[model samples]
Target chain A: EAEVAQSPRYKITEKSQAVAFWCDPISGHATLYWYRQILGQGPELLVQFQDESVVDDSQLPKDRFSAERLKGVDSTLKIQPAELGDSAMYLCASSFGRGTEAFFGQGTRLTVV
Target chain B: ELKVEQNPLFLSMQEGKNYTIYCNYSTTSDRLYWYRQDPGKSLESLFVLLSNGAVKQEGRLMASLDTKARLSTLHITAAVHDLSATYFCANWVGSNYKLTFGKGTLLTVNP
Candidate 1:
């Protein structure tokens, strides 16, 4: 089945270390989303990308978190100085159109010590 | 702020029982989605309700949306042990395609 792809299913790093997560959306999907899900809480939108251009990033912490989608297909979310609170499942989803059903990736589980 | 809420937080059910999960949103929306997640796994799309009074069913789960009321329901009939998972409802906000997820309903079906 066609699915969104995410890398580094699990990662463990020291606090203040740099961490990055990668996602490859399904073919022909134009919208990509990044969400942070903490334990026992719903997923929160951190960023939204329409193709390679960022549509929204208000919820993302600009000082530490950054995301980019190059060539309008693959995306990368980076954290220059990861913090203890940054430990959560980073979920990536893609959809063909706005207000459409989004397909989610397996997500990258990051743990900062 | 647009928000989605699910009731009961957690549910314990016996196999072959019928139950319904409720989802209520805080704002106006025309689209809603239901997703299921197993322990330590990604989300699995269950249903998408795009209009008022939209109803869809698959397997043992039937989902209905009442857009006018800003509510949605996921009903399970004769649920089995394998149906144990976390269910989330996402409400589409405005035109940005951003979805606000509910706290999720954790269902545990005991045999």
Candidate 2:
């Protein structure tokens, strides 16, 4: 079965350093999502992409976070000057379209010291 | 803003027992989803409830949705050690197709 692919299963960075995570959604998927999940909480949407355009980023911390889906196939999420609180599981998911089931990737676990 | 809430944040049940996890959303939505996650792992999609009164089942799990009540449920039958995991229910916010998830219910099935 085709699944969303994420790179660097784990990442550890110093506080204030820059870090990035990558995600490649399943083929033919038109919607992509990046979510941040704390250790004991549910995942929270950080940004959403439809094709190559951003649809909603209301919960994204723009001051230090950025994401892009340049070709509408794969995406990258970056955090500049990462903080301790930024340590979390960054999950990428994709779906065929609205109201469809979104499949999640294995996820990248980030820990900032 | 849309909010999702799950009750019984932690549950400990014996094998062969049955239980249900309830999810309540703050707003109206036609789509609800149930996902499972093991410790130190990513989420696994369980069920997608697309309409009011929609119910789906697989293996030992069953999920139902009530769009009018803004509620969804994940029912586990004949619990087993393999069924132990954190289950989350998410509401699909229509305008942007964003999913708002609940805190999750951590279930531990003891054999």
Candidate 3:
């Protein structure tokens, strides 16, 4: 059972600090997604990557957030000057290809104080 | 712009009872997905409904999709305490694979 892997299961930082989350999709998966899940809401797509190229990032807050999948296998999401409202569960998911069933990682929970 | 809506945001039912969770989408999409999440856990893939009249079942859970109606349903049969979780339905956005998810239905099966 190949699963997406995420690092820093839990993170706590002060507001205005920088934070980063990492994700490694299942091998051979070409589509990767980053999402943010609020406490009681559905996950919101932040970015999508296909073979190291960004396909969609319309919902991503580019002013403070950035993501990169340089090798198209693993990805990194960084947030500069994190804000209290930025606290949420950062989820990573991947699929064999676009429009396929996606597998999600355990997620990285970020908390800003 | 795509939107997914789920009904009965909170449901509490007795163990061994049956219930259905409905998902309605604002646009037409050939692919729809169902996922389950326990508290503090990641999403667990439940079913992938592709095309109209597609149905899939596992254990006591079953899911169906109707592309024309822009609707999907997840039915739980003879549910148990362990079946309690938050269920979400998601579909592709526009011509891409970016998913738009429903707010989710929180089910609590009381024994």
Candidate 4:
């Protein structure tokens, strides 16, 4: 089975530093999503992309966080001047289209000191 | 806005015991999904409930959905140590691909 791939399974950085995470969705998937999971909470949607265009980013912290999928295939999420509270697991998921089941990646765990 | 809620945020049981995790949503949705996550790992899809009375089962875990009631359930039977993990239920916001998730239910099946 094809799976979504993520890089830097774990990242540790000092507060005020910049960090980025990468994700490659399964081939042919047109919908990609980025989610953040806190230690004791369920994942929350941060952004959604359709093809190479952003569909929704209402929950994303625009001031510090940014995500992009330039070619509608792979995506990158960056946090500038990371804060301690920004530590969490960043998960990537993809599906063939909207309103369908999505496959999740192993996720990148970020920690800010 | 859509909201999802799961009850019994934490559960502890011994081998052979049975328990159920409940998921309730605030609005009508197109589908409901259940996922399991082990510590320090990613999510594993457990079930996808798409219709009013959809139900699916795999091994010792069974999930049921009732769209009329806007509820879904994950039932574990004869649990084992391998079942120790956090389970999450998420609902697809109408028409959109976005999902609203409930606070996960952490299950600890003690041997």
Best by lDDT: 3
User: Pairs clashing in candidate 3?
Assistant: none
Candidate 4 lDDT, tens digit per residue, A1-113? Answer: 89999999999999999999999999999999999999988999999999999999998999999999999999999999899999999999999999888999999999999
Per-candidate RMSD, Å: 1.1, 1.2, 0.9, 1.0
lDDT of 3 at A77: 99
Task: Give the TM-score (0 to 1) of chain B in model 1.
Answer: 0.95
| Model 2 residue pairs with clashes | none
TM-score per candidate? 0.97, 0.96, 0.97, 0.97
TM-score of 4: 0.97
Better of 3 and 4 by lDDT: 3
lDDT of 3 by residue, B24-103 (tens): 99876788999999999999999999889999999999999999889899999999999999999999877777888999
Docking tier of model 3: it is high
Error of 1 at B20 (Å): 0.9
lDDT tens digits, residue span B1-111, model 2: 568999989999999999999999987778888999999999998888878999999999999998888888888999999999999998877688787889999999998
User: How many clashes (backbone N, Cα, C below 3 Å) per candidate?
Assistant: 0, 0, 0, 0
By DockQ, the better pick of 3 and 4 is 3
Q: For candidate 2, write residues A1-113 as lDDT tens digits.
A: 89999998999999999999999999999999999999999999999999999999998999999999999999999999899999999999999986688999999999999
DockQ of each: 0.85, 0.91, 0.91, 0.86
Model 4 sits at a Cα RMSD from the real structure of: 1.0
Which of the two, 2 or 3, has more TM-score?
3
